[model samples]
Target chain A: MPSILGFGACLPPRVVTHEELAERLGVEPGWILEACGIRERRWAQEETVVDLAEGAAREALSAGGLRPGDLGAIILGTGTPQRQFPGVSAELQRRLGCPGIPAFDVHLASSGGMVALCLARELCRAYGPVLAVGAERMSDIVQRDFVKETAILFGDGAGAAVVSPAEGPLEILEALWAADGDFASDLCLDSGGPLKMNGRTVIMQANRKLVATVETLLARAGRRTGEVDLFVFHQANLNLLRQVARTLGVEASKVPITLHRYGNTSAASVLIAAAEAWKEGRFHFGSLGLLAAFGAGFSWGGMLVEAR
Target chain B: MNTLDDIRALVAALAQAPLPEDPEASLFEAGVIDSFGVMDLVAQLEARFALKVPDEDMLPRKFESLSKIAAYVASRKA
Candidate 1:
C-alpha cells in the first residue's frame, strides 16, 4: 500500500443542534444525547453531496501538493448519493476539471469509507494518485416527520484522502473487512424512501464485529491495544464508543470522537473525525492508530496505520 | 441446576449498571439494559456456556430476566 498523501473533511454551513431538532420534532433534546451522545449535527441547506465532496476533494488535493490533473482515479464511498446512477465521483471529477480520470462509487454505508481507503491503496499501485472520498448526506435520507430515531441521528458532510506513491505522513500496515448480508433487513433504505434501522441490532452487531475486527487486525499485525496511539472509529454513537473502549480496555484519550458534534454522517464520520485529529496534531508523526467502521450491509472493517 | 446466577453476573457486567435483586425481574422493564445490552449478555452467555445462540433466538424476551436467560441456556445446553 502507498502512503496517505493527505486527509480532508468538509461540513455544511448549517448546524442543527439537538435543541433545534427537538423543538421541531416536539421531543426532548436530552434524548438525543442520552441515546446517541450527539448534541449537534450538520445539514446541507443548499449544498448537494457533490458540492461537499468538491470542497473536501479540493482540500485533499491541495494538502497533497498536487493538482486534480495529478489524480489518476477518483473513488467515492457514499451512503447518500443524490442520484442513483452517475455518482458524486463523476460530478466531482468534472468540478475538479479532471476530465478523463476513471471515477467510480463504492456504496457500503460507513464501512465504504474504510473500504475506499483500502481500495485506493491498492489502486495506487496502478494509478499514480487515487483520491478516496467518503461523503454522505444522511440528513437527506432522514425525513423530519418520520421516525425520530432516524431523524435526529444523521448529519451531512464529506471527507477525502489522497493516496499516492509519494511518501507522506501516514503509511498503511494492514486492512481487513467482513460482512453478513443475512442481517440486511436490520438496516435498509428503500429507493425514494426514508432510512429505517433496527437501531439495537445495528448497535450490537456493529459493536461486536468492530471490536473483533480491531482485535483480529491488531493480532495479525503483532501489535497490542496499548500500542495504539489513536483510535479513529466511525462516529456512530457515543455510548457505543464508550462501550467499545470499556470492552477493549482502551482509554478515552486514545479515541477521536466526532459523533458528539456531527452525529452519524455514515461514510463521512471516520474521515471527518480523522481530519479533525490531523488538524489538532493528534494524528501526528509516529502515531500508530486503529481505524474501524461498520454499516448497513452488516459490514465491519478495521485498518492499522502509522504516521511518519 | 439453573444458570441464573451466572446469567445474572453476565448481565451486570454488560449493562455496567445495577441489576434488580429479583431473578425474575425484567431488565428491560427496569431500564437496566437496552436491546444492545441484551445482545451483549447473549454474547457472554454463548461464550461462557459454549453454545451458539442463533440469530433467530436473539429476541429480547429470551433474555429479559435472569430466569429467562437461565432457562434458555439450560435448554440450549441440554
Candidate 2:
C-alpha cells in the first residue's frame, strides 16, 4: 500500500477580523456568520501561492528524510495560481530544484488537495515517491467589494504530503469523490475576479452532499461511523462540519477543525488539519482518519487513511 | 447583563435572520447559523456581558442550540 511519508502545512499568518468586514460591507458580522461559517480567515501578505507551496513542500521533504531530487513528480491542487503560464507546479519544482521532474497541476477548486492525494497515491503505486501539494493565495484573487464573504471563508496557505509505497497502517484505503454541477452556483466566484457565493444555497447543498459522501466512503471501507478514529474534512463553515457529523451519527469530538483559526484554505484545508492533528499526537496505530472536502467545482470527496 | 437571560437577549439581537421553529434543534442542524455567525454571537456576548471568550470556548456545541448558548454563558458567569 502507498503510505504518507510526511506532511506539512503553511499559513500566511495575517488574520482579518469580522469587525473589519462588517465595517466595510455595512452589515453586522453576525449576518455574514449566520449565512456562512466564517469569522476570521487568513490572508497572504507578500506571499505567492507558489511561495507557500514551496515552503510547505520543503518541510515535508525534510521531514521525510528526502530531498527535492528524490521526488519523482509534483502534483499541486489549487484554484488560484500565480499565472496561467509556467504553472504553479513547475514553479515549485524549479524553486525546490527538482528540474525535469513530472510536475503538473490539478484544478478541483476546494477539493483539490484531496484529489491531489488520490492522484499521488496512484503515482506512488506506479512509481515510488511523489509530492502532492495544495496551495492557494486566495487573498490575491478575492475582490475588495466581496471581502466580507471571501475574506471570512478563505485563508491563504499551502499543505503538502509525500506519498510512497510502504508498509504501515497509514495506507490510503480509498477516496470517494462526488459532485453536483447543478449546485455549482451555490458557491462560486463567478466573476473570475473575486469570491462570490449564494450563502443560503451553499448551506443547503453542503448539508446534503457532505453527508452522502461520508456514507458512501464509510460503506466502501466497510467501517462504521464510530469506528473511524478521527474526522478531518474541509473547513468551509462550522455548520457543515457539525451537520456531517450529526448526519453520519459520529461523535463531534472525533472531528478536527481549524476553521476558527485558519478559516478555509481551499485545497489546503484537509491537509492542514491532518498535519496539525499528527503534530498534536492525535493519531495512533490503526486510528482511522477520514479526509473530505467540497467547494467551487461543487466537487467533494473523502479518503479513509488508516494510521500506522 | 451577566445572566443567561442576557445571553439569550443578545442571541435575539444578533440574529439577523429568523429563529428556528424548534429552539431545541441544533442551530447547526436547523441550518440557522454557521461559524462566522457563531463568532458574531460570541463577539456580542463578550460586548454585552463583558466576558472574555477564550479560543477554546468557540465550538459548535456551545452555540449548537439557544439553550446550549444560554448554558455556556450562565456557567461562565457562575
Candidate 3:
C-alpha cells in the first residue's frame, strides 16, 4: 500500500479583502462573500509559478526525509503555469537536481491535484517515491476590472505531498472520475483574457456531478457517506460546497473549508486544506477521508482513503 | 488629509508604482494595481484617511484612476 509520506504548502504574503474588490466592482461585499465564501485570498508578489512550486516541493520533500534526487517521479498540477513552454515540473526537476526521473504536468483544471495523486499511487507500484505538487499564480493572469467572479474565487498558492509505499495514516482507497462535455462551457477562461464564469450554470453542474461522483466512489470503496470521518472537497465556491454537502448528506462540520480564508487555488485547494487538517490534529488513525473536486473541464472526481 | 491628493498619496505609497504627477493615472488597466494590492491600499486608506472601504466598494472605478480614488476617499472624509 502507498500513503502520503509528507505534506507542505506555501502561500503568498498578501491578502485581498472583500471590501477592496467591492469598491472597484460597484457591488456590495455581500455579493462576493455570499456567492464565493471568500473573505481573503493569497497573492504572490513578483514571484513566478515555478517559484511557488519549488518552495512547496522542497518543504514536502524535506519532510519526507528524502532528497530531490531520491524522488522516482514528480507530478505537478496547475491551471496557471509560469510559461507556456518547459512546464513547471521540468523546472522543478532541475532545481531539485532529480536527474532523469519521470517529471511532467497534469492540467485537470481544479481537480488536477487529486487526479495527479491517484496517478502517482498507481505508478508507486513501479516507482517507489513520488513528489506531487500543485502550484498556481492566478493573480497575475486575472484582470482587475473583470474580477467580480475571478478575484473573489481565486488566490495564489502551492501545495506538495510526498507519496511512497507505506502502511500508514493515509492511503488512497479509490478514485472515481467522470466528465460531461455539455457542461464544459459552464466555467471557462476561453475569452482569451480574464476569467469568464457562468456562476449559476457552474454551481448547478457542480452540485449535480459532484454528488454522483462521490456516491460512486463511496460505493466502490464499500462505504457509505456516514462512514467517512472527513470530507475534503474542491473549494470551487461557497455555494457549491454548501449545496454539495447538503446533497451528499455530509455534515458541514465534517468537511474542511479553506475557501473562507484561502479562497480557491484550483488544484491546490484540497491538498492545502488536507495538509492544514492533518496539522491541526483533525485526522486519526483508521479514519476515513473523502476527497472530491470539480472544475473547467466539466470534470469531477472523488477519492476514498483510510488514515493509517 | 481629506483632500483628493491625500488619497492619491496613500494609493501611490501602498501600490509602490509610478502614477502621473497630475493625478489622472489609471490604476486598473495601467497595471498599477491588482486584487491583492487593493487590500493593502484599502488598509492604508483606512488608516491614513480615517475612512472605511466596505466590500461593496471594491470596484475598479473606485481605484481605476488616481483622481477617482482620491475623490472617493475625500468624500468619505467629508
Candidate 4:
C-alpha cells in the first residue's frame, strides 16, 4: 500500500471577506455566509497555479525527508491552469527541478485531489516517490454573477502530498470512485471565462454522492465508521459538509473543514483541508482517516487511509 | 389520500416546523426548511405519493410555499 509520506498546503496572501465580495456583487455579506457558510477566502493576487503548486510541493518534499531528485512522478489536479498548454504540473516539475519524471494533470474539478491521490498510489510502486498536487487559481475563474452564485463561493490555494511505497505515517488502504456525467451541466466553467453553477443541484448531487462513496469505501475497507478517526471532506460548502456529516452519523469534531475560511478552492480544497489537519497533529499513529470529495463531473470519490 | 393535508404533514415532518399561516409564504424565507429539507421532502413525497419529481423541478421555487409545494405535488400526482 502506498502511504502519504507527508503533506503540505500553500494558501495565498490575499484574503477576501464576504463583505468585500458582497459589495462587489451588490448582495449582503451576511446573506452570503448564510447561503454558503463561507466567511472569507484566500485569493492569489500574484501567484500562478504553478507557483502555489511548487510551494506546496517543496514543503511536502521537505516534510517527507525526500528531495526533488527522489521524485519519480508528479500528478497535479486543477481546474484553473495558468495556461492551456503543457499543464501546470510540468511547470511545477520544472520548478521542483525534477523535469524528467512523468507529470500530468487531472481535471476532475473538486474531486481532483482524491482522484490524483488514488492515482498516485498506483504510480508509487513503479515510480516510488510520487507527488500528487491540487492547485487552482479559482479567483481567476469566477465572475460577479449573483444569480450563478459563483462569486462568493471560491478562493485560491494549493496542496500537495508526497506518496511513497516505503514506510510512512499513513498507508492508503482503499479507494472508490463513481461518476454520473448527466449532471455535468449542473456545474461547469465554459471556455468563455466565468464560472457557472446551479447551486441547488450541485449541493444535492455532491452531498448525496459524498455520503454514498464514504459508506461504500468504508464497507469495502471492512472498517466501521467508528474505526475512522477523521473525515477530511472537500471544502465545497460548509452547510453541505455539515449535512453530509450528519448523514454519515459522524460527529462534527471528526470532520476538518476549511471551507469557512478558504471557501471552495476547487481541486485544492480536499488536500488543503487534509494538510491543515495533518499540521494540527490530527493524525495519530495507527489511526484511520477517511477522505471524500465530490465535484464538477458529478464525480465523487473516497479513500481510506491508516496512519502507521 | 388528501394531497394538501398529506403535504402539510410531510412539511411538518421534514422541516420539523409548522408551515406558515400564509400558504403562499416562502418556506425558505420563513426559515422553515433549507435545501436538504426540501430534498428529503421531495423523496418522501415521491415514495409516499408514488410520483416522480423531475430534476429540473427540484428548485426551491417549486416548493417555495405550502401552496406551491401542494400544487407541485398535486400536479405530479395527477
Cα displacement (angstroms), candidate 1, residue A25, comes to 0.8
Candidate 3 residue lDDT tens string, A1-308: 78777777888888888888788779998898876668888888877788888888888877677788778999998888767767789998998898888999987668777777777787766877889888887776665446575766788888888888765468878877766676566566653466766554465456666777788888998889899999888887776677678767788899888988888888888778877877776778879988788877777777788877
TM-score of each: 0.90, 0.76, 0.76, 0.87
Report clash pairs, candidate 2: A33-B36, A33-B37, A34-B37, A37-B35, A38-B36
lDDT of 1 by residue, A205-298 (tens): 7777778888988999898999899999998888788888877889998988888789899888888787788778886778798888999888
List ranges where model 3 is wrong by over 4 Å.
B1-78
**Global fold similarity of model 4 (TM-score):** 0.87
Interface CA RMSD of each prediction in angstroms: 2.7, 9.6, 11.0, 2.8
lDDT of 4 by residue, A1-308 (tens): 67899999999899999888888888888899888888999989878899899888898888889999999899999998878878888888888888778999998879888888888888999978999999998887775334427778889999989999877899889887777788788788888546767766777667768877888888888889888899999988777888888878899999998898999998988999999988998889889998889898878887899998
Please name the candidate that would achieve the greatest lDDT relative to the true structure: 4
Query: Any runs in candidate 4 off by more than 4 Å, and if so which?
Result: A143-148, B1-4, B15-34, B42-78
Which of the two, 3 or 4, has more TM-score? 4
Where does model 1 exceed 4 Å of error?
B8-30, B39-68, B75-78
Quality of candidate 1 docking, DockQ: 0.38
- For each prediction in turn, the share of the native Cα contacts (below 8 Å between chains A and B) that it retains comes to 0.24, 0.00, 0.00, 0.28
Residue by residue across B1-78, what tens digits does model 4's lDDT show? 577778878888877566788888888888788777877787788888899876556665788888988888878867
Model 1 interface RMSD over true interface Cα atoms: 2.7
DockQ of every candidate: 0.38, 0.03, 0.02, 0.32
Candidate 2, residues A66-129, lDDT tens digits: the string is: 8888888889999888787667998898899978768999887688888888888888766678
Candidate 1, lDDT over the whole model: 0.84
